[model samples]
Target chain A: MEDFSIIKQQDEILREIEERQPMFTPVQDFSSLEVEYASNPPFQAKIPYLQSKYSGFRRTRGDGNCFYRSFIFSLFEQLIQNKSHLSNPDSPYSQIYSAIKQKVLDSGDILNAAGFLPICYEDFIDMISAKLEMIPTTEISQLEDDFKDKIIADTYVMYTRFIVSAFLRLHADEYSGFVEGYPDIVSFCNSEVDPMNRECEQLQIIAMTEAFQIKAEIEYMDRNDRTETTLMSFPFEYTGPDFKIHMLYRPGHYDILYPNRS
Target chain B: MATRTRLLRELKGKTEEFSLNNVGDDLMIWQAIIQGPSDSPYADGKFTIEFRVPENYPFAPPKARFITRIFHPNVHFDTGDICLDVLKSDWSPAWSLEALCRAIVALLSAPNADSPLNCDAGNMIRAGDMRAYNSMARMYTIEFAQERNLN
Candidate 1:
């Protein structure tokens, strides 16, 4: 009980910190990371290489759902920036948005198959669809402000987690072998994939990229022997030239990355 | 607001083993009655559980406590807190109170002795004293959770 009380106190402190900090901070220069990691040689060594390829980054709250938050926020930001070409049905942005919208609408079937009752997930899915609908019409600043609303942001993360879990469940035969500790795919999804604030892993990343039909690249900044941060792309076979979302991963946290100036 | 709406919808869904009702029209605080699993020592018992839904319902799990005393490895004898993963770290927004009721009913039958809130009950199961464990649990159910006693 004493241990439990200590944990509860720590959680209160973390929650207080979370309230003071923005859910997603505005774009910050790569030099910010350099200063933050100055004492750590391995991280400092990779900053130059990272800077060469990426201009700036948007910091996400260190909550466990950072990966999903960063990915969705970055994707929506891109779509909003391309709003000029939205009227042109032939434009790549328009095509991508249309395809994603359809996927969101069709996700009900996946959730149903995963044993989720429609009554439970309908509100979450509606919030996700409403936000997606706002992208073309809404300004970038509005998108950031909307995400700052904890309920709205958490609702999106929850739905996205469901999508990831459902995808893994549907393709259990393919992923069951890769799952390490859990007895089977269902239990793995129950504990690891569906829970709020659970960190995402490689399997979840693959599942998200595949289920949403979005390409992503992660710049892994680690304390390894390598001087440069490794760039790993999801959906392994996709050697595509364009990735819809780019993220910087340092240890447990993830943040959105912006491309270098042309 | 969403929590209230979801609870209203869940009130309509039917389940034989458990039923949940609001406490004096308070949507956030619910009262649930769970029938013991037929094969378990707790059979014929009707356990009362109090569920306190946090403001962020579905996102955060509702706090469930066994109001009626029961001898089990996972439920606290004094505080009534049940040591269940779904109520804590494993919670998903996809789960409804109805689902939680079902999970609770399942937990009564398969109490995890490894992570016990009631050490005495847990030790009994761990020591392979099935006869003593069953009888003690059965005695508690009759004393505190029997249908007549619950009323």
Candidate 2:
């Protein structure tokens, strides 16, 4: 009675929904929710509102169950796909950046309480790529315009977080005691260390200079295959730490020689 | 019928009845026994493989594992996880089951060492030590797949 035009618009949207039914036919099966609820009576007791909302409101239990399951399933699917993308070597760095952006958007109370940002594996690659570009190479000027500062900054922070997290997960037995002790290593390292500065690069060079330091540590800690060595070893122009930088070596693959440390 | 379904039917008629006993609704797990391709390290071998289809179906790619062990850079030793992209992110829903089976058979012959599932195998292959890789392949074939009976 109030607005005939608004009612017509609503009807148009409803018609669109009806037209799209065939496209969504696979997801239309919600009858199983009723059977699931009947089998598991405790679920109704725990979430009485769910039962009330569906059954009391004259909506089928199957509809509620299907909707919930589909939502949960899609969420998990996205997580796995994102994780796989991160682990994939061939995936472009931008994919990881977008994933990080999505994580920032999706983050809420649970992630905030955990005190960590959700970053996919590709984010790690993006971080490494950024730091690698900043090593003041003779070839630095030749780098593509796409490889610039903010990307480098974001990547560096994300990479450090990934490394610290991986180190913690891998060496939980050796480092679990230190978990409570060093609650904010990634944040502290990122803020205080300044990886962009010459000092941090020197520190990284020193750590890497020992033959098999990164390799042995990563192998022992991560338990992942050594295949990543080639990908991990790029970036480290000598910061005057009594070490000879070897070219023609793979990125993640390196054999560090530390004459000073020895 | 879908191209995949049709292709699957054709392959089933041509090949021996190969199926896995244990599988869930989410996973369309199958055990395949493939005859080795000619002029390959895996020639004259009958290799076994396992396929796992995810619940997300066409969106997320399925996972494939070698049930019968083989010495290859693209496959793990203890676990049979393959390192090929076709099975991973590069997978397309357009890929047919027959094509996947053929690819698996082909992978037995040629392995990409640049991206290796087994570092030792990759190292050996990269070093051009084909003898070592072949011997290892032969050994695994004998140990895991009863290659002696095939010959």
Candidate 3:
């Protein structure tokens, strides 16, 4: 009887641990996204907005980290597309690495000037920046290896999350001035933006787009609205490049979307 | 994976207040000594924490525990295990080792007894027994943490 009770208690503890784990991994592979759009007609109607902008999108996990994962995936693929546009067929991965290296450095510079403590994220950024430079292979073949390894791909996602977190923390006064209910910076960061696995909302979206200087469009498909999808661009009023990433936000989740130019 | 890089940076960035080094070339196992804040009951205390990083680091949080006994609400007194939210589900890849050490110091200064691992310490705080809690914490620091300061 005693043994049975102890085993039952152990099962309960295991179940709780499993529940605490994320429903999905940091990143997942791409799949045909049309099936997803086709299933929801209301959502399908909004695809034209995306169709005018993007080619296709890769699906990320439903986990809260999807925003970070999907954002990095789109950022790199965009660089790859531009690099490959020359028809050189030579691997664009080297250029992609350089582009990422540049972006992180740029963000780091901005954060540093804003009085953000680099020590908080110095190693996190360095490791990611080093990954691009340290691969030892300036060749495209090495990028193929990077793609196959799940940890490498996920590392990019982790780095992106760090970038956003640092930006939001450093520039709290500039951004959080309008935000309601946070008495101070740490509380605001801790509750709304800093911690891992907290689903990002408007504040995070703005901070990331402004910090990275990447224009982005987030289209919302609501459970209540059957006819129209709300398509709004980020950073409230940043008028920059006409072309940028288009993301599909369906209540609690985000995914990349592309134009079907073909 | 990036733990060593951050540790080195932390060392350079903060010349004092922290002493972090790997036990060996393993890089995965590190010993950290955090200087308690001057204003706290644990002031002048040098607390030792062991950081155990997993193979898939940056993706996972290091398991940090005090090797020195600490009479605090968030720290498990006997095992020295901490109940910091950031060390668990709240961990983000953005946090560096230096950030963690600073957080540990902050934890020592202002412990959150609301959700504590050390029931006795938590209860004392909740019961508004500040005088007793301070004396007890100071005693632990004197016994376990002050020796490093003296040295």
Superposed model 2: Cα runs more than 4 Å off: A1-262, B1-27, B147-151
| Candidate 3 regions with alpha-carbon error over 4 angstroms | A1-56, A84-103, A114-150, A169-171, A178-181, A190-192, B1-14, B36-38, B148-151
TM-score of chain A of each: 0.93, 0.24, 0.65
Please give each candidate's TM-score. Answer: 0.94, 0.33, 0.75
For every candidate in turn, the CA RMSD to the true structure comes to: 2.1, 24.9, 6.4
Q: How close to the true structure is residue A84 of candidate 2, measured as C-alpha lDDT? A: 39
Candidate 1 yields a Cα-based lDDT of 0.86
Compared with the true structure, what per-residue lDDT tens digits does model 3 show for residues B1-151?
Answer: 3445655565567645578776777677887888878888899888889988776566567889999889998988888888887887566655666678889999988989788788788889999999889999998899888865444
In angstroms, give how far residue A178 of model 2 lies from its true place: 56
What is candidate 2's lDDT per residue for A88-200, written digit by digit as tens?
44553334334434443333322223333332233335434443333223132222222223233233333333333333333345434442334554433333222211122
Deviation of model 2 at B100, angstroms:
1.0
Error of 1 at A24 (Å): 0.9
> Against the native chain B, what TM-score does each candidate's chain B reach?
0.94, 0.78, 0.88
The candidate maximizing TM-score is 1
Worst 10 residues of 3 chain B by lDDT: B1-10
Instruction: Rank the models by DockQ, top first.
Output: 1, 3, 2
Output the TM-score of candidate 3: 0.75
Q: Which ten contiguous residues of candidate 2 chain A have the minimum total lDDT?
A: A212-221
Per-residue accuracy of model 1 over A1-262 as CA lDDT, tens digit each: 4434654785686698698778898998888887899899999999889888888899998878899888888878998998887677878788778888898999999899988888788888887899888787899999888788888888878888889999999999999998989999999999998987778989999999988878998999999978899999888776433436999999999999998867
Docking class of 2: incorrect
